[model samples]
Target: MLRDEKQYIESLRDGRVVYYRGDKVKDVTTHRALRAAVNHASLVYKWQADDDKRGLTVYKDPENGDVSSFFKIPRSSDDLIERFNLIYQTTRFGRGTFNIIKAIGSDAIFALMLVTRRIDSATGSKYAERVTRFYKNVIKNDPAIAVAQTDVKGDRLLRPSEQPDPDMYVRIVERRKDGIVVRGAKAHTTQGPVSNEIIVLPTRAMTEKDADYAVAFAVQANAPGLKMISKPERAAEAAMNDEWFVTGKENVETESITIFDDVFVPWDRVFLAGEWQFAGSLAVMFPTYHRFTAISYRAGIADMFIGLGKLLAEYNGVDDKSHIRRDVVELIKYKEMLRSTAISSAMMADLDTETGIVIPNKVLTNVGKLIANESYMDVVKHLVDIAGGLAATLPASSDFNNPEEKVYLEKYLIGKKGTNAVERARIISTVKEIISSFGALYTAAMLHAEGSIEASVLELYRSYDYKDSKKLAMYASGISEKL
Candidate 1:
């Protein structure tokens, strides 16, 4: 029922209780450390309001007489591709905050998958009707929805049912005629406190004994008994605020752990309940959608890093240096490789699910994710190398006004013709923040998020067609007998 940027902001400001350390946070909406991220989310709404971005943010759905997010009911390959492009545009603006965009895309994709699955078959549930209407209302008003996927997971060594603490993963505590009361906690929830609604799901496949943990639903971010505890920011604004103007702004959003103390979810919002078999389907489907979005979104992030590296090369008067030029060229190679892999995944995509919505071949998409994971980090390292020592050694902006230090800074930090030493130093400092600082965290996240390096390698091993390749080798070599 939420609509508009102002309304979305107001929803987060009112009645939502968030914790940091131990005490309840009264106002995270404007807190400096958190404001950048909070504001970045708000801009998503503002984009819908704008004449330029509105085209990308909202779509007309024939199922309902309303506008909705592109992900709410992406029925065709074109619909899916547009969603990828839209996310990429937003992500390019905040390559520093593309992680938040990734989180948003992940939940949106899951929601669409659910809606599509429900609507396509006569035997399917009417959950899609409820979601379609919800999404329509959101688009007409432009509300923000966050997603919670991972569970707190008490013991990594044990399954959800085998864990010593039964409540570690969120599960149904009680089912009522009107609703169900959920008791447990969700972790790594991005934009948890500030969103209008949250789509919650089981982190992994569940066994028969884990049915209670297999439930999936959408609940208001501030639903009764729901409490969000925000994680600390990477570094305070003092380190990057001034530099943001000279460089790019940091997309500062927070992720958090959300505790549900017997929180009730009404029947209307509960999509999958007590359907343990569907839990694994949801788990596999959601990450494939997430990886699709990541393939393009992270490619855009690497593109930005490529730009910054070129800028730093020029600023350091090494634009003409052969080795520096080679470094810049290598960075481009990595960046382009990420783009090609992502685009190929899109081009080769086919409809694999019962739902009509086309999904990127998981094998190809995972390859894209793998290439992005490795190349993006190398891009960061190469950029740092080209940026040189000043990125790490530059003094704070506070030193700019000190009369004693100003003379020395002015004499030695100067670069080339037509640019003052002070200006070059400022530019170099900003570049340092991008390749180092929180920017480095974003680059690392590109590779590790969704799944880790080991996970991707394992998937590659599982997905390859080894038996077919073996058969082909035996036939071609005339060794018809089985090995």
Candidate 2:
């Protein structure tokens, strides 16, 4: 486990593990776009070691009774609540670029708790104990880790075992007395290649026939036989080469696709295998935890945008304008709604089947995610409105370098009489970078990631407590309800 942020950055600097775009990246730490994101993530680890975030970021692991990072294991309902609060706090520090790092933390912490509880109940295995130990180590020594969840999904309609291309989903292809060999690729893995470690798990619920696909394990990012592919650089990549930081906003980090080419996993690291019955339970539990985390963390992101909107409105001398005021009001309401849902979910947490990992209630968890989806988009829309047309039409940060265009940029971009022309231009370019670059992509991901809004609604519909509510309604009306 990474002992501190220094090691985390060192790992990123120590590169070259078959990560490809069109060509392989020899070292991700120095790359123009990827480096900024890596530095951003390192801040999370660095915070754990700093005196300021110690209270929020550090927690005692119940198993080893050692103080670990709050991102490690959420064992009690209180543990879950504390973690829920931590993400909200961290959002202010990074302006929400740190959201995905916490997203990975949510999945790893909750899944370890859920699975450890289940295994402890079923076979009285030390799996839960081992997990707690691992978690404590990570917390004691903060690490930058990522979770791999999505499968290549060869044919959306076909199950993993039923797919003609068996490697479409990451699955166990061979088992030996000492370990297992896995093949296939996982897509949309948040910060997979740059992370210190990667937690691997089954992508979906599985049946008995799909036993080979129901596997879970954890490994170092540099583990042999693993390859990654990120979304190709945007058309904006060319522009970034010369001026990545000309805009105050950093270039967004890339999340790569990870392929396991018959990778060997040691027996000790393998947490689950062929537990087809619990496969659905695992899949369901992941979203419950992830959605709750998103509710709080993404709201933190909206909080950032709202603050930005207010600043921009004032700088532009439009804060007193009715439309801008109205937009700010709407934005604040959306942020408040997301905050409420996340807090409610955390407050309503419960214990699970085994390792005694406390999880948020399923119905509210799904609702939390839905609220995030709706609120995130609304906040962005409001920000866009308050920002006015300049949000779209601003010149690139590079234009400031030109002798001729610099004067026009200064004159035209001036926001208020008190502010210097250059400062106004800088702020406008930063806003554009926020709205146009990979950071923009992160906002879109908040809407669709961790399952779409439609999917969340379906989950809520299935878990609705309709029967009890219906019976109560009938009694209140003095009418006898029959089955």
Best by TM-score: 2
C-alpha TM-scores of all predictions? 0.88, 0.89
The digit string of per-residue lDDT tens for model 2 on 1-483 reads: 324666777866555474555777778777654666666676666776778886676655565443435465556666666776787877767655544664575576567666767766887766666666666656655556678878888999999889999999888889999988989999888777677778887878898989988877877777788887766545236346436333222424567888898889887777777776667776777777778777777777777777878888888899999999999888788778877777777677676644556777777778778877866666667888877777778766678788899988778777867877766655555556667654546666877888888879888998887997888888888796552
Candidate number of the best lDDT: 2
C-alpha local distance difference test of each model: 0.70, 0.71
- What would the per-residue lDDT of candidate 1 be over residues 90-169, giving only the tens digit for each residue? 77755434535324634554545564464335346666665556555555555566778788899988888898889998
List runs of model 2 lying over 4 Å from the truth: 13-16, 59-68, 75-78, 123-126, 233-251, 401-404, 476-483
Per-residue lDDT value at 440 in model 2: 48
Tell me the lDDT of model 2 at 130. Answer: 62
Provide the lDDT at 339 for model 2.
78
How many backbone clashes does every candidate have?
4, 3
For model 2 the TM-score comes to 0.89
